[model samples]
Target: MRRRAGVGAIQKHRLEQEKYKEKGTEIQENQFQQMSKQLEVFRENLEDFASKHKSEIRAENALNHMVREGLAWVDSQEPKETLYWFPSMFAECVSA
Candidate 1:
């Protein structure tokens, strides 16, 4: 009789553990779905913004690229009075 009772208790514990594991898996799936939805919304907003400001974005990227290249060129040159011209050069680069 004691052995039978022990077996019953072990079975009950196993069933409870299985239930908790299933619940945890469900919660994880729900959270993953929510995150995926949020990411989709974010991507849509980014696409909208890009479409609205395509020209401005392209110009800004071009200016940034030019500035980086100019700065790199300046860095490769030896220090001299011409180095002081970088500020004006960068300002003109951005304006253009």
Candidate 2:
């Protein structure tokens, strides 16, 4: 009887571990999707900016520099580690 209980406890522990793993995977997938959507928005905005300022090399250079700086700052941030919030940072540049 003791042996049977021990085996059952191990099985239960394994099942709990599996559940935790599944939850972790779901969270990671959600984060990935959010990041992808953010990237698409950023790309569309950049393209719009480029179109609007096609003849101005300085504008393009400034935009590129802002993007690089934003990306570097995002990289330094430990929480996200990527420029998923680029549009907000880009807006700061535009306003400046």
Query: Which candidate tops lDDT?
Result: 1
For each of the candidates, the C-alpha root-mean-square deviation to the true structure, in angstroms, is 8.6, 16.0
lDDT of 1 at 10: 91
Q: Report the lDDT tens digits of candidate 2 across residue range 1-96.
A: 344568888999999999999999999999999999999999999999988888797755665687788642334466754333456758789999
| TM-score per candidate, chains pooled | 0.65, 0.53
Candidate 2: Cα lDDT at 89 = 56
Q: Provide the overall lDDT of each model, using Cα atoms, as 2-decimal numbers.
A: 0.78, 0.78
Model 1 C-alpha lDDT versus the unseen true structure: 0.78
The ten-residue window of minimal lDDT in model 2 covers 72-81
Off by over 4 Å in 2: 1-5, 58-96
